[model samples]
Target: MAQARRELAERLREGGSESAALEARVLMEAVAGERDPDPFGRLDPDATARLEAFAARRLSGEPVFRIIGEREFWGLPFALSKATLEPRPDSETLVEAALDCIGDRRQEPFSVLDLGTGTGCLLISVLSECRAATGLGVDLSPDACETAQHNAVVNSVSERVSFVQGSWTTALDRRFDLILSNPPYIPTAEIATLDVSVRDHDPMLALDGGADGLAPYRIFARTLPDVLAPQGIVVLEIGAGQEQDVIALMTQGGFAWRGSRRDLGGHPRALIFGYALK
Candidate 1:
């Protein structure tokens, strides 16, 4: 097994994979269908075939997450859809921020709305922490919406969570006490420069935040506040170096920039906002 992993790792490294060892381990475990202490041990023909296929896909620049079909976020496993954007560790920062902002409301029967809810990670994660909270997750892609629904079931929150297919906040007439979004924030030019794992596999609809990476924020600034309940706050994931610009856009859109949150790398990755109560 060690030998197989080494060979796979060599293949991945030669293919420009920065996380070759990690990717190799992930693929081996996935193909073996469980955690095997001795990964190099003999495998059934079926498992061996699966491992080769998985390795080939990885060598071609496909993400291990895409090949594995799920990612863990907020300490919970979320299934991916054809149109779903694989959840990232950085995205967990937004979940932490939302939980902090809604500290006292965690146990309350509050409401949440997640715009551009891809795998429903944001809404489902937040809802999991808030036992009594109900949420509506909206996305432009119906396929993504369905995945979110399944994710809700997987996390045991489906009873309190609902999925919708539509643009941000358009399908619902009600306001929520908490709004969360990890919208597309990569600029058009930046998209091409992204690592192959992202640029090639992630659905473009979940990326492409327009020329400046602030296009969705502009739409968010204009639309989100209207769906927020009195005193409710919004938590949005943003691209690196977009902190001030996003704050400015929200301010101009009639929202008060409450605060921000940083990811593991200390990048200002999430912006908090609230309606100005005009």
Candidate 2:
């Protein structure tokens, strides 16, 4: 059994399914009470069965994060469920832009509003940086709200971050110092054409950006101004080539162009806008 397990692990690696080996190792360790296994010793029968099931799912294109039910974002591990979209590294740009906009303003207790806050990763990360900050994360899905709340507690920022379920900023009663969003910006028609990992796994509500792929931007531009404090900033993650159109929508809705930022590949990935002039 020991030698057979070693052969299985090596074959999985050779088949270009490296995660299978790691998953098997973890399961065997749990079953055998060895943090680091010796000679790939015997795995509990039940544990081996579970590993096989997980491997089947993984091999069929399920994300590791989904299978494991956790993902690391901004150096924090967040619990994930089907209700929330998987947090991606690109969204970190929104966090960075928000912090930069709040520079040296720590004296004032600022309120942050995160639209479409999935898993609370963005809001939690920001609140972690600005101890004086309090955040409200809103999502349309109740499951997402629950997931976000769980993440807040996990990150030890439950007192500073609150999760609400709603569409847009309709439920917000007070103006916020900062409002940021990485809403669905993928064009409706283009969604099906995306890679299998994205198309099959990610939630459609988080991906469909409407016919023009700029609908959410238009809505945010219209509604955020009302909820944003005077001179406050709003940063949005945009789809590729949608920057100009998004800026136009912001202008029409009375926002000022504060400038744009690019992702690691130099594409215009995030847009920063200032609240309308009084």
CA RMSD for every model?
1.5, 3.2
Candidate 2 lDDT, 137-208, residue by residue in tens = 999999999999999998889998889899998867899988889899998889989966678888888899
Model 1 residue-pair collision total: 1
Best model per lDDT: 1
Candidate 1 error regions (>4 Å)? none
What is the lDDT for 202 in model 1?
95
lDDT of every model, 2 decimals: 0.89, 0.82
Candidate 2: pairs in clash: none
Residue-by-residue lDDT tens digits, candidate 1, 1-278: 77787888898999888889998888888877777638548767898799899988888888898999999998999998779999999999988999999888789899999999999999999988999999998899999999999999999999998988998877578888999989898989989899888898999999999998889889987887679898899999998889999999999989998899889998998889988767
In model 2, where do residues sit more than 4 Å from their true spots?
1-42, 106-108, 276-278
- Of candidate 1, the 10-residue stretch with the lowest lDDT total is 31-40
Q: Model 1 residue 52 lDDT?
A: 91
Question: How do all models score by TM-score?
Answer: 0.95, 0.87
